[model samples]
Target: MTGRRRWSTDEILDTAAELLRTSDAESFSVRKLAAALGTDSSSLYRHFRNKTELLRAVADRILLAAMDGYRPQGDWKQRIAALALRLREAFGEQIELAVVWGRYGSGGTGSRLVMEELLQALRASGLPDDEVPVRYHRIVILLASLITSEAGINTVAPKEYEQGMEQFRVAVLGADPERFPALAHFARDIRPLGADRPAAFEDILAAHLAQIEAQLP
Candidate 1:
């Protein structure tokens, strides 16, 4: 009992976060994390029971960090949109962890905060009790969509990302001038990633907000 543990959970989580930032999902491993900490996987297991538990804790830590300055404001719709955007930014910020929890469906306490606020926002709409659950689920789906998507792959896998970009350029940017008139006409605007993706997210969020507004008396 007198001996100090090799590494604390906070330290392990921080180190794991740093690894995930640079390493893609396929490359990141418990062995790599232990190596980074000048220890071994068993040492990490000493603190966490298993890999799934460790990943959930890491995702929880990142989610909590993403809410560092969050304070609810504005009306119901604005408040809901804000929560979505904040967590979207959070998920995008540490998507590797997001992929972990998304696969396992372990959002834990950090996601619960958003869940609570979203329910409040739906209630603030004054809709009948029957309507709230469905809308709440839709918003959660919108938020979770970023996890399995290609939104944040640029940081984790630059080479593969660039390759995908090149393929898009060939397909859309370099399409035939005559056979596909619409694509040729909007060639410049059809590029992937960049502002287009976030704009699309905004469009979806705005549409969802409008849906909520339409239901209000």
Candidate 2:
């Protein structure tokens, strides 16, 4: 609002979103951003109130990008799985941005809207309208949890994370060769860690969606 030169909101947002994707919020300061864009830091103030507002816009814009060009067909369950995977893939590409997303307004408008759209799709797919919201909440929780977990693992102690997964495997499937022979035998292969986790998450989510579809029909 202060500058004579006109810059579209989309342009500003795209610039900010790109920064968020590549750098941590702490590192991506307004001064540095202006330097990167070859503009004065004060000039950005015309487009955004402050860094917080700019970050919100960035998160929203990235969400829009994630949801864009997504055209779904076939059974709704398949479509939903595709949508979830697309979002996960997009977020995975920008781990820092994903962390921002996890922390934004308990994860912001863009995220909430995506879930709403998925809930509507579920309802259209024969799920009860009222039930859709709760079910959708669960799915988003799982998705957000996975993203947050990955972000945490990347930032914190990697060794502790590996240990935690090992413990989880023992807790969930147990280590009882006498009683749960198969789980005890296959536990190592069943609970993979580190980089393999995201794929495992997608597979588990897809299976859940398939089960929901199975229940519907």
Candidate 3:
């Protein structure tokens, strides 16, 4: 890679996303990206207004990749469930990307497309028109909160801390039933630390959809 070579918009976004995935958001900057591309920071300004815009473009790329080849099938609940899982899978890869999305808001074509699909799925669920927006907001907020929680845990918690928590949970579950009856009774249903993330995410999405279904006429 030479500074003499001109980079296309797609190339810049792809490289930017790669940089984001490899590094933390606090350390990501237009200058850093330019240096990585063997170009000057000013060159990025032509494609993006600033670092925030560049990150948004990268986030859109991730969203598009996640939605690629995904078609909503089955009933509305099923369709929404599938879309939610796709959202989780897409942002789950890079926590910073998800955080960026929340900070800057999704204004790209990819965001619009996904939002439309989500609203359509919600409508198909037989939810009342007046309540659609409320439900939509709820779903979006839920996804963001869950992604943040999962990402924060991964980013801030060391392996030793996680292991210690697991050990404590085990100890609590193994306590005498006389003193910790509730813990002993539900021990089998508790998820261990570092449990299958995708599976747990899917379960959350499924439960959300089920709740929506219950509200339907």
lDDT of 3 by residue, 138-174 (tens): 8888877776667666665587767777787868777
All candidates: CA RMSD (Å): 3.1, 5.7, 3.5
> Using alpha carbons, what is the TM-score of model 3?
0.80
Superposed Cα RMSD, model 1? 3.1
Q: Model 2 segments beyond 4 Å from truth?
A: 1-6, 38-42, 105-113, 151-192, 210-217
Worst 10 residues of 2 by lDDT: 104-113
- Against the true structure, what is each candidate's TM-score? 0.80, 0.67, 0.80
Model 1 lDDT per residue over 111-167, tens place: 677678888888888877788899898877776775445345535367786788888
Q: How much lDDT does candidate 3 score?
A: 0.81
Flag regions of model 1 displaced more than 4 Å. Answer: 1-5, 147-150, 156-166, 177-181
Which stretches in model 3 have alpha-carbon errors above 4 Å?
Answer: 1-3, 154-193
- Tens-digit lDDT string for candidate 2 (117-142): 78767887898777777778777777
- Model 2 lDDT on a 0 to 1 scale: 0.72
TM-score of candidate 2 versus the correct structure, residues matched by position: 0.67
